[model samples]
Target: MTIHSVPGDFHIPFDDLKVVARGLVRPECVLALDDGSLVTAHGQGGYSIISSVGEVSHHLAHCDTARKYVPNGIALAPNGKMLFADLGNQYGGIFSLDRHGHLETVLDSVDGTSLPPSNFVMVDEHDVLWFTVSTRNVPRSKSWNHHVRDGFIGVIDGDGARIVADGLGYTNEIAFSPDRRWVYVNETYAQRISRYPLTGSAAKPRLGKRETLVQLSEADLPDGLAFDVAGGLWVTCIASNKVLLVRPDRTVQVIVEDSDPAHVGRIAAGIRESSLEHADMQTPGNSRLGNVSSIAFGGRDMRTAYLGCLLDDCVRSFRSPIPGVALPHRSRRIR
Candidate 1:
């Protein structure tokens, strides 16, 4: 693999993240609901609808189709259906939640092969569904063995499903530029952000040259990503508890980092709520948040940034200085 480098020097520090809820077990994906609430996919198995007051308004588990469903990332369809990507060793697939709160399978296999461990899902303005399979291995723990490069990026639509890029190093969250000219992805195990120019029509998109935007040490693992209106990419690093903002010009800033690396790992292990020792726990720099896995921007004016934590019971949130680019298919009303 050829390494593409871009040079830029910038580091900004701001650790003012506050927890908005608690009791949410391993919330992986958190997105805004039009009715001023937030919906999240929990790692244990199911989804939770949370309110700003830190209350779990609703909760739903997997349907019979995906008995072993382990949700990772989630998105909403135009008609109010919720789409989710699940991760599991045996059978991983995409599931959907209808208005009646019923879960159903969307796709379990692409071509003739069952999905490896699905990570993130993104829907474009053209309604093309783009997702990432972190690795070909069933259990995600084996992904640490960097020797295999089976990670791939795929797109699905009415026509069918096919991989657009392969040989990635544990691909995580996938995002697109506002103009839809570039695609950004988090290569977690590689500790780098890889991007490629997106071309061709909406129905038949293609990836161009691959380039590295930001690189970090092995201590950091980039997990989820979001984009601001100005094209700045916000990345969540789970291991180091850091949030980085990468600008279009290649300059990067550390917007959030407040945790002990070793401590954060234990938190990410999905400890039971009864096992947490509040007195023994220490939060870095007095920040109220830790062990975050994903982030999404929404709320009034699109400046509210909601963070998904792997260990914590609730999502953390803060007011972003810049408004985020409204995501496609976001519902304007809640059923």
Candidate 2:
């Protein structure tokens, strides 16, 4: 898979992308470390590392005995702890997965009631952790309903866990603006990206009114989000198997769309099983299918953006037109 950097009117074709690994079990959210290794949450209840070239390395932390801990989104803290969201029902919430595969609860409940299954997480530069819960309604499949709006965005800092925002349509990834003045979140079921003003201090901030930044087509289900240095948002749309670029001025452009029908079918099946079964699952790593779950920028100059998948066995890569804005711990790994 080779994606070329060329000019196009509607969208830039993603060419020259190489599959980094094969045989991953529903790898969802991926984060690139300083040492060139990628950490991603697996649907099989743990986390795995991918080499710079895409080899599936050893498990960073696995929980075969605790299969209910469906690792969803992940972020590595400066203290060497991997904070990840558990989408399982029995033990759903945010947890810190240690190198030894031990799990420690971070934010399971607020005011006593248990938190719903977590979706995505982001750790800011100030060590503040922000996470989202898709919804409390379960058999786990209820989250697929677009009308479900019980989802919420929460914050965990030195203080504690607090609900910063609520009433969302299946929230997925969360990102901050380059200027740190705005917080963006992807409403997957709603097929839109909404931005909220970042008020108060960085460590203890507040989310202001919700503003729709971009409303995607109904056929598109927006998922992961990343920001390029040019202040453009790179969004991965699931089901539709496409990536989108939303500019600061709210103009949306299709960056790339996977044309493989077989891959698309597999992705759609994988998602269906997830909603109905709510159990552990895996996928055959082949075909560069778009069920893209997350995006991150890495490489020597930070121009390489990696696309993590759900049904695809391997992660995909492509070069970006501009460098991506560095995350809080971009390329930094735990020693």
Candidate 3:
């Protein structure tokens, strides 16, 4: 499968970007729909719905009074429910939120082991659910080192939920290839993007051997994964505030970036020395993008790029030269 590269001269100008939605807290994951609306992961609890006209409304969960709702990655189910990964302080799990704000537990424990701070979740076209756990470390921040490899990917379908792949180096996000033949994921601590071929029966699915697609540098701790219609993979880096494009040919391009060299250097050093502290990732040097963490394509043409961030209160938007691969939820309504 030969994939060509995007135009070398194409890049997103920071000055031309616009704010799509505001007053969001830790909007770490954004899912754009065909009608120009967006659903992003809310830091405080549950998720927020941004209407096409820029109206914002929150549907927070009141499931647990003791545990704070720290949603990381989110997905829009075909039935209009929102599936969010609970990154709670002491525990982690995947939960679903209905239109009425009713919450239901999807998976809190798998294979007799309780999930540890779930990171990302996705519902594919077939209604099959997939998720990732960045690491098994108690604090999770302890696995910020490149050497930690307890991360894994799990799937839920007709056969029930089970881990299909393990030994990942801090998996952050996962995306299926355009044809749904391959599953791609970003290993944040390992600084690489890897993919596995889809094999076996649909009911009893399996993933083939992992293939390294992109080995990134410490400065680019990949956090998000999205595929453009042209076969390019767009990755968002947390500390450096960079959006990179990995072409089908495996060549890399910096589509946009805003960073403080000194701050990025400190983060890189901590990762290299396996001493990264949670405090180190608390604040980003640049406030413009709030350490952009995720990217999504929306709008009528699917050429509008929406950025999710760790520290920002809004999702940023920009025009892209290439249209993005339409996600399974693009045509689904929030109801």
lDDT of 2 by residue, 1-335 (tens): 22223233545454656677777777788887757888877776667788766677545455456456777898888777778888876557888877777767778797578887788877888878899987777755666645567778888876688888889888889899988889999988666799899997878889999998887653467889999876888998876677788766667778777645554454455444444233322322232464787889887788878888887667877877788888877746754
TM per candidate comes to 0.84, 0.86, 0.97
Candidate 3 per-residue C-alpha lDDT over 1-335 given as tens digits, one digit per residue, 9 for 90 to 100: 56454678788877778988898988999999888789999888789989999999888887656678799999988888899998887789999988777888899999999999999998888778999999989898899888999999998998888999999999889998887789899999899999999997765678999999999885788999899987889999999888999988888899988877888899999999998888998988754668899999889988899999999899888888888999989999875
Task: Spell out the clash pairs found in candidate 3.
Answer: none
The CA lDDT at 168 in model 3 is 97
Clashing pairs in 1: 24-313
Instruction: For each candidate in turn, give its C-alpha RMSD to the true structure in angstroms.
Output: 6.5, 4.8, 1.4
Ranking by lDDT: 3, 2, 1
Residue 211 CA displacement from its true place in model 1, Å: 1.6
Among these predicted structures, which one has the highest TM-score? Answer: 3
Please give, for residues 1-335, the per-residue lDDT of candidate 1 as tens digits: 22212123333344455667777767888888645788888666667778756678555653555366778888776656777888775667787776566777777788789886688776667878888989887555555533556788988876689888888888988888888788989888666789989987887788888888887663466888989887788888775678778777766677777757566555433222223233323342234455578888888788888899666677888877787778775554334
